[model samples]
Target: MSEPPVSYKRHRFPPQIIAHAVWLYFRFPLSLRLVEKLLLERGIVVSYETVRVWAHKFGPDYVRCLRRKKPSRQDIWHLDEVVVTINSEKRYLWRAVDQDGYVLDEIVQIRRDTRAAKRLLERLLCKQGCPPKRMITDKLGSYGAARRKIMPKVEHCQHKGLNNRAENSHVPIRKRERAMQGFRSWSGLQRFVETFPAVRNHVVPPHSHRSAFATHLHRLAAMAEWKSVTLTAA
Candidate 1:
């Protein structure tokens, strides 16, 4: 006889707990331990290690699933790179976000040269399946080289203050990094930032006429659809 199908239930932490934990990590720049302490005060006894694991595992998955069901529309992309210290060594973190602050792609590389920029752009284009109408970057000459080779037709603009949008988007990530004691490895940094955008996008409502309640309802509905689709695919 065929085995019975397994049932996977959602986590038992109240929606408030899950939401609060995610909010604290993404919004306020709190360490997993700090968040664990806060939850304990509310009578929940989860461990900080568990919180870190949850943030690493479910955080990005949740964000991706949420976006898959309700994809954002962004035709313009702003790309930038930031230097971060990992394991006492300096590394580069490449980030791409839309004009509306939706994170599109992120990666970590050991170098910040033309090759690194090209790799980051290629990965972003492959995932996004096309170039944005316009790409904005700072005065970095490497950006010019990458754009010329990969997205020749796409407008590349480099001017003072023009790339601030992408630069400003890094602030939240910096805050989060400071709270978590900075990343220890390039892999860890890449994974966390990759997941960070999705979580951030989930809490932001699209610019539309929908009420906050309506937006929440839509997000919940999308989450349900994502769960069903993921289970079936699995």
Candidate 2:
């Protein structure tokens, strides 16, 4: 048989601690130093650099595993982009989400044009395995051009109000940018953005018309799912 997961092999810290550190860094809008200080209060003496290394090393794997555990997405998709300034350079962060506010995929680019929109659509198609019944976007001509070229049959609604779902999704990333004081490099930014939404999708449950007990049970299930996904390779 193949060896068991090496989540903690040769590491000074246990898998639980390392996983917790990675979780804290991505799950919340906390900086590496803050994560270190929080752990220090708990008697863990990990440095901020160690936490940074742990995030870059483990975050992508965790997100990939988490995505594998998600259910099939909706037929309606929302796409949008926001400007992220790093070291005085402006970049575009393209994001796509389903009708129920579940993040599907995101990417970073220096240009916001038909090409960028097509790139996002292609990534969505490859990952989602199908085009949506309809897609909503702001009054961006690039989205119109790209949608026509790629998924021409998928209804493209270009309305400001109609794309609020996608626009609203940027709020969290904007908050994160402030916490980290903006990303230093495009490659580094892309790496974290790609993984962050998957983790968010795993932890967040759809809002319910059901009772509080049902919500609590769902949260318990989400927590259990998180542990199982993280330990799959451990």
**Model 1 scores what on Cα lDDT?**
0.74
- How much does candidate 1 score in TM-score? 0.78
In candidate 1 the C-alpha lDDT for residue 39 amounts to 92
Give per-model TM-scores. Answer: 0.78, 0.92
**What's the distance in Å from true for residue 155, model 2?**
0.7
RMSD (CA, Å), each prediction: 5.5, 2.7
| Position 85, candidate 1: lDDT | 89
Count of backbone clashes, every candidate in sequence: 0, 1
lDDT of 2 at 84: 86
lDDT (0 to 1) per candidate: 0.74, 0.83
* lDDT per residue as tens, model 2, 47-130: 999999999988887766553433353478889999988888898999998877888888988899899999999998998887
Off-target runs (Cα >4 Å) in candidate 1 are 1-23, 68-74, 206-234
